[model samples]
Target: MKKAWIIWLASTLLLAAALHVAFMFAYPYILMNAAMDRLSANGERENVWTHAPRMTETARLIVRPSPDLAYSSCVYDLSDGPVQISVQPWGDYMSLSLFGANTDNYFTLNDRRMPESGAIVILRTADQAITDEQRAAAFEVVDSPSARGIALVRRLAPSPERFAEAEAARVQEECRALNAE
Candidate 1:
């Protein structure tokens, strides 16, 4: 009888311990599954950050010295290819960027001339046929051996005016393309 009681008590304790462990593991999973199900049920909602619709981020143009003309001109581009703009991820505004290609050295807009507080550096669309004057006046020299890009910071969000339907569609299309791949 005494042996039977000890065994029974031990079994009860073991069962209780197992139940505790099981609850610890299963409770969160159930909660997460339910949460995900709820979110999926409401997946049709659309907003600015929603993934289903398209969005455009920004448009960049390349600037280069023009062979025929004496000034640099920006060739407007639709950004059909993947373009990467590199900038330090700190601060409220963009100070430097590596225009079209990463191999192109990073340029700081405030290269030698100081920019007023809110001036934006614009690069032309094409890589060739830019005039020296356009290169000098239209685009800011972000990086040079001379003074530039020292205080330039990064801007994660552009001005509201920069957002457009075409840009949003491109972003959405890119996301869809990436998801398909």
Candidate 2:
């Protein structure tokens, strides 16, 4: 009876360990889902960038957001069609990152990678093939695995005072849904 009780206890511990591991893995998914929901509620519908206020001691949208950087985000729904992003690299440090529904960052580009045209146009193609017109444009095309996602534009501000400059730069950026034609 002693040996049987020990075995049962071990089995229970193992099951609990497995369950904890599973929850650890699922935690990010749950958090991302909640964040997406909040973003949809707060952000402009779709394909329009919404600049977030500068991070402060009271600000809590992103976990531990840095005051040294400014953020702008756009929720994307590519089920109907692909989306295009146009950015003017203005700051000393700037980056654009694409995050899928699962919170996985699939693509990122920084100021160093900015095109020579003084602007960068990125096309996130849906699961389907791109149109001939999209091929004709001077845009960087990338096939996206997920149709619903978020586009984040981050810019480094040298000081809290510079946040406005970064915001100004990002406000000029454009996130637009491409026409099916």
In model 1, which range of ten residues has the least summed lDDT?
172-181
RMSD of candidate 2 to the true fold? 3.1
Question: Residues 96-177, candidate 1, lDDT per residue (tens digit)?
Answer: 4322221223454432243443333433234323345534543242222211111112222344433232233223211111
Each candidate's clash count:
22, 0
CA deviation > 4 Å runs, candidate 2: 1-22, 42-44, 118-126
In candidate 1 the C-alpha lDDT for residue 104 amounts to 27
**C-alpha lDDT of all candidate models, in order:** 0.30, 0.76
* Candidate number with greatest TM-score: 2
| lDDT of candidate 2 over 1-181, digit per residue (tens) | 9999999999999999999999988887788767766766744467778788877889867787877788888888777777878777764888888888778998888888877544545556555566677666735776666777788888888586688777777777888877644
